[model samples]
Target: MVLKCSPIQLAHSVLLTLGIIWLTPVWAAQEIRVGAAHFPPYTVRPERGADTGLLSKLLNALNQLQSDYRFVLVPSSIPRRVRDFERGRVDMMMFENPAWGWQELSYTAVDMGLEDAEVFVARQNPDRAQRYFDDLSGKRLALFSGYHYAFAGFNSAPKFLTNTFSATLTYSHESNLLMVLRGRADIALMTRSNLIDIQRYDPKVKSQIMVSERVDQVYRHYALLRLDAPIKSQEFAQMLNNLRDSGQLRAIFGPYQIDVVAM
Candidate 1:
């Protein structure tokens, strides 16, 4: 049958098809994969069906805002993680302070909304060995392998001794704390909030541990994003800033005793 169709009929059919396409659930599903390390009290491994700490809370909030994103724990090594993200093996990853000097690596600084402070934790034993950086010269000092110092240049003093003192480096803050508790390592450097969280989980260790000294006060943590991420870094930063201003950020972290550092 040969029949003439009106222009309006063709236009209406096209609009209906377009509307159906736009209404599909797949159109709203934006897949953004994130990588993280197992840093206790912030991010931890799910053991025996346990929830990973504060990071879990943060992820929950993120999920509320986003529908199609998931975070996976990457090993605590910055170099390897960066390589993965750069090569498009992973979509995004969070970092405290990345050493990547490349302009292509876009990052959104979260400001952590917490105070920047470092503490030197050691065992409480006067006879064994009091607090002495010199004593730590030949021994090993442990820090989280993948973490970076936000205020690296602020502390001008050399971390290691030159000639008479040489120390080995160990990774993993949790392991480092264990070493200190067991008297394996002379001292372990950690953040104050992290120490508090650890103590909460293991109260017996609190009696044996002591915060020797405040190393630095401006060691704020930040969330570094990849430049090629589907979400804009600057926009994320603004959203975080707005979250802080609205008091929602503080509320989210306050229960966990994490203070928010205003941007």
Candidate 2:
């Protein structure tokens, strides 16, 4: 079985190997930092080895789809998002609404074709059933620290909210819901999506909470990108569209009891 190749044959084999390597596409991976707030179901601050949320799942899919761009989540808060974006500490903000105050900033908006709603949540008090959310006067409320609501005339100033409406400001939806559950607050304004997710994660919490019919606003979420971001709005939209067409979105959000809206 012993065989020897000529010098010319060996040279040809080496050249073929070099040609294949040269023709291979070698891409420089670009890092895309996506700002993340404490929006449950969409994003929860990632743990050491656990990426637990919708945004994490979506970002993982995006990373897998393209080798050129590596999407990542950067920590931020509702009040500090502007500072994060303006300082170039983060490249983009995900699942944002224009009304959240990025209008004056240099950024582009891309409609994500996903939506959620802000609604009122209260404790499951049988005695006060059907009479809890009837009036807003003289009622204690728990609300997110820096969110503008339709009922507040979209005024999210902490001083105005605490002084005018006597609202208790919380940094997290879980805290707001907990306040309502313990009767510490009359009602808490929360996202319908978050409520759904909380119920999914802890079924017992569902029995402790009751939701109201009064919806604050329906949110059509978007990705707000800086003007100097590595990716443009349209290009980002195209990548999302590819995910939608391939049914990846449904696979990711469906199990969480969320419906993927058509783009």
Candidate 3:
């Protein structure tokens, strides 16, 4: 006859199985996949062979913390990038200003300690440049796909353009600059820092670019992580905060001429 198992013995076996399942290595190793655009100086492709700008240094600092990170460069659009992140296709991304409507998606945002000034880049011709926004009253203005602008005092104007300006709006920082060079669009909106970075990578675009107006100032260059990421989002936020406190951020961005701002 077979011996009957005791209740305590059966309980011990159950606990052992549960413990093994909980202690599995797969539960411990987590990865974060970040999405970004080739908005040079802020973020760019490694194949470009130019400086990765502040984003590169920021990523390096994050890597130094030994965190697992994967980067994906989205083409010409931030809303698309956000869509990818929401679907769990990507774990995080960079440089999302708080104004973007993704705060509820459970992504943690960290201050990369950089500020950006928004400006309109128009043709150097006085009449043409002055008519940029005016002529676009019923037309489209090119803006970075997911960028936001406060418009300072022009918030009530009918033609105060931005990504949210209208469905007719078309945007591509590189393409927009190219358009200005070719006189295709009325105006292109961009950040001063980004313009400088783009010029550094492609000198040919420089002559066609000039700041038409300093529209608004905003804190730029922050890191974002999916709220449901396997690793704690708070931990990542804290790591960035520590980097800022220890001056590591300063050291990393100093060479790029970026100024850090607290969020």
Q: Highest TM-score: which candidate? A: 2
Against the hidden reference, what TM-scores do the models get?
0.69, 0.85, 0.64
Report how far off residue 6 is in candidate 3 (Å). Answer: 39
Clashes of each: 3, 0, 2
TM-score of 1: 0.69
Candidate 1 lDDT score at position 94:
50
> Could you give candidate 3's per-residue lDDT for residues 90-125 as a string of tens digits?
676777765566656776777656766676777666
Candidate 2 vs 3: which has more TM-score: 2
lDDT of 3 at 226: 74
Worst 10-residue stretch by lDDT in candidate 1? 160-169
lDDT by residue for model 1 over 19-49, one digit each (tens)? 9988887645556666555556665653333
After superposition, candidate 3 runs with Cα above 4 Å error: 1-29, 45-56, 67-77, 126-140, 151-171, 202-208, 245-248, 251-257
Please identify model 1 stretches exceeding 4 Å from their true place.
1-23, 46-51, 66-79, 99-112, 126-140, 149-171, 255-257
Candidate 1 yields a Cα-based lDDT of 0.59
Residue 137 in candidate 1 has what lDDT? 51
lDDT of 3: 0.62
